[model samples]
Target: MRVEGLKLTPVSSAGIEQNASEVASGSKNFGEFLTEALGEVNQLQNDSAKASFDLAAGKLQDVSQVTIAAEKANIAIQLTMQVRNKMIDAYQEVMRMQV
Candidate 1:
């Protein structure tokens, strides 16, 4: 039996430090993230609507495609609504807090 030369090297300290920094500063502010997420949801809804219209007009052949798209859009909208409700609740709570 012969074993070939095997070498495994761990990540460098500088690489680890860079990765930590990236994780710490990579994300946008909460409001910006929310805005971007809502925009994505809006886009999904628009796509769903377009797919449904295409299906209705006999332009799309697969009913399943339209159904899936619609369901995704519905779920995204519901999630967005829930997030909005939570944000409102948080804001109200903060307002009620004694400063």
Candidate 2:
């Protein structure tokens, strides 16, 4: 087996700052982001289901691939839930603060 060195790229702080500013300025639509995230979750679940069905029908040759797909979908769902919980908590905290 041949091993290849991994190539890594450095991220610039300027780009990150610019993105943060854009987000704060409402240049990007928050609803679009949420919609895209939900769409991704839906797609992952569909893929996992298809992989499982294909495996059960003997249409898939690799069991590991199907398992990986299912795991990916599960992780995505869990992460989405955690983000949602955090958002709710943040909102509540903001509401509790008085001007």
Off by over 4 Å in 1: 1-23
TM-score of model number 1: 0.73
Q: For candidate 2, write residues 1-99 as lDDT tens digits.
A: 999999999877998899899899998698889998999999999999999999999999999999999999999999999999999999999999999
Count of clashes in candidate 2: 0
Q: Encode model 1's per-residue lDDT on 1-99: one tens digit a residue.
A: 999997988867998888678668975566787788989999999999999999999999999999999999999999989988998999999999998
Best by lDDT: 2
- Clash count per candidate: 0, 0
Question: What's the distance in Å from true for residue 26, model 1?
Answer: 5.4
Where model 2 places Cα greater than 4 Å from the true spot, the runs are: 1-27
Error of 2 at 73 (Å): 0.3
The collision pairs in model 2 are none
Worst 10 residues of 2 by lDDT: 27-36
* Reference-based lDDT, each prediction: 0.91, 0.95
lDDT of 2: 0.95
